[model samples]
Target: MNDADKKRLLREMIFYRRFEDRTFEAYMERKIGGFLHLYSGQEAVATGVLEKAVVGQGNKNDYVITGYRDHVHALKTGAPAKEVMAELYGKETGSSRGRGGSMHIFDPTQNFMGGYALVGQPFPLAAGLAMGCKHKKTNQIAICFLGDGANNQGTFHETMNMAKIWNLPVLFVCENNGYAIGTHIDRSTAVRDQYKRVAAYDMEASQHDGMDIDIVMEAAEKAIDFVRSGKGPYFLEFMTYRFRGHSMSDAKSYRTREEELEWEKRDPINIYSKRLIDAGLITQDDIKAMEREIDENMENEIIKFAEESPEPRVEDLTKYVLDDNPDPRWIGPLQK
Candidate 1:
């Protein structure tokens, strides 16, 4: 990539980090409604994988499906910042028209299938999409993302086996963020190494240092290449950690403050920024300017959409209930 392209990728990653920080603040202030999952510590994994996937594809034809801890992915996949914020705010102009809220932001236009709230639902859904693409002779690959917790689901096993057997175009990525809600990875699985989980299905899976953007980028490129070259389904497990609690209401007693601070030292943004500066790819002033610019842009959009966007009318509740027959005005005009 050229300097301009590199800078754009860096800036995009910064925007996701800063936007997520603001979303956390919004959750605390009671602006964002429902469950809020923060992706602060695992920025590099999403940022890095997305850069190559979107860049290499040349556009948004490729698909992405992931679990509820998905705001960052949604934003990076081309969903508008204001619309994402509004979706959290439960406004009508949201990506799902205020229906899905924070957990289920879907933008088919951007090829983002669904920000599925159910822990393991998207695994099979993603495989099915990949199968469809294969049958249709489309070159587009479906990047299915899941958490460590979701990997243990029955659907995950079935999907992996079937994807490999049928030779579907799918990249299975697990963001192993150490803990499943309040439970640690050790307690959840006998084998804490998530990449090894795919061994049963005879699929290609590997672990990578997800805190470093370059490391993740290299691994992700190989995974994508494998799938595109007719390797069927590939699995990638990213060893990462989340800075915030499981949700806005989490008491967070499962993890210690010292542990949190320790992970903070490996903060993806800080690590990447230092690497860029040390390598002379970017300067300290450049980083500062980038942050400021992203912050300003996000703030402006947050206010613009949240305050200006209207909520869907309660009388129109029955509209868009089914895929086959969508009712634009199901409830009709409200009676006086």
Candidate 2:
């Protein structure tokens, strides 16, 4: 990578970290609601993989789908930060036009597909997308992002089998953060390492350190190349950790502070920032300036956009509903 790319990635990682932090504050202040999952520590996985997937693949977009922890993925896949923030605020200017808050961030024009609220939902949806591409003979592939717990879902195994049988061009990424909503993987998952589980389907797979952007990039470059080369599906497990609890409501009493602190030492933003500084690509002052700029943008642009955006009007609530042939019983009567 060039000096410029390194510096840009460093800035992006820092921006993502601050973005999640600000999101936590917004949730606390009641500016946002619903199941708020912050991508605080897992920035590198999304940053590295999404950025690398499009590199040298020309300007075409690869379809991306993920679970509820999706703000960062959406942003990386070309969803604007202001629109994401507005989505969280449930305003009319949101990516989903205020219909789906936090969980369902859909922007298909950018090929980000959508984030699913149901556990393991994206697994089959991604495979189906790949199947469509294969039928159409398009070079485009589907990228599926799911959590460690999601690996146990029946869809995970089902999709793996079908992808291999049909030779679908899909990449399944398991963000193994060591816990399934406070339950450690060791306790719930019999096979701890997620990549090893894909062997049941004879699929190619690997694991990598998700905290380091460079490592994640190197791993994703190979996986994405193999999948896009028409070699069928590839599975990658990123051993990452989320800094916050599963959701805004989670107290996280299940984990120890000592363990959290240990993971904090490997914080993705800090690691990337230090790497950029040590390589002389950027100075500590430059990093601070980057943070200041991001913070200001979050407050001035993103927050202002969400705050100033109009709330969805009550009369417009049924606009997107299936009213073309609506059932009278399900629809009932609207309030006057």
Candidate 3:
């Protein structure tokens, strides 16, 4: 990457961090309800990984599916920030038409399939997407983002075996943030180093530092290249840490303050920005200006868009439920 590209990525990561930070505030103020997972410290994983996938195969349209910490993934896939924020507010103009919030940010135009709320749900679905791309000979691939805790789900193993047998064009990227909703990987899962978990299925896998965007980009390029070659599936485990609790509701009581601060030292946004600054590509004032711009955009535009957007109507409660079929059985009869 050129000096300019590095600087651009640094700002983008900062924007993502601030975006999530703003969402945290919104959730606290009761604007965003339901399961709110912030992708604060793990910005590099999605930003770096998808950076290659977007341009891969001549931008032939790759598919993305991840677990509920998906705001960044959706944004990186070209979903507008306003639409995402509106979804969090459950507004009429939100993505998924205000039906699926936070955990289910779906933008099919960009081929970001959706974020699944179920543990390991995206696993098999990702393989299915890859299978379709292979069958259609579109040269497209499916990128599945998963959490470390999700590796224990049965779907992980099943999909890994199936992807290898069929040689599906899918790349599974695991964000090992050391915990499964307060349960550390060591307590509940075997093989703390998540990359090795795929070895049982004889799939290609590796681990890296998710705190560094450039490192993730380099690793992702190699992995995407191998998968796009139709050699089957590749699993990448990025050792990362989440600055916030698993969800908004989580107090993070399971971990100590010392451990949290230790991981905070390796914050991805700080690491990347520091590198750019040290390289003489950017200055602290430039970073502050970028932050100011982001703050203004979020406050004046993104948040305003969501707050001003109308909520989904009660009469149309069942509207997007099932192809506009209006199934009273599902939502239990709309208002009389």
Worst window of 10 by summed lDDT in candidate 2: 51-60
Q: Put down candidate 2 lDDT per residue, 27-82, tens digits, no spaces.
A: 88999998899889999999999877752232367889999999989888888889
TM-score, every prediction: 0.93, 0.94, 0.94
lDDT of 1 by residue, 1-336 (tens): 566766776787788778778888887788887888877788888878877786223244678889998888887777777888888888999988899988998887788888888888999999988888888787778898888999878998888899989988999889999888899989988889998989999999999998898899999999999997787899999999988888888989998899999889998888877877777889989988989988877777675677689998999798887654546477446556
Residue 86, candidate 1: Cα error in Å is 1.5
Candidate 3 per-residue lDDT, tens place, 298-329, comes to 99999999999999899997665466654678
Q: Find the 10 residues in a row with the least total lDDT in model 1.
A: 52-61
Candidate order by lDDT, highest to lowest? 3, 2, 1
Task: Name the top lDDT candidate.
Answer: 3
Cα deviation of 120 in candidate 1 (Å)?
1.1
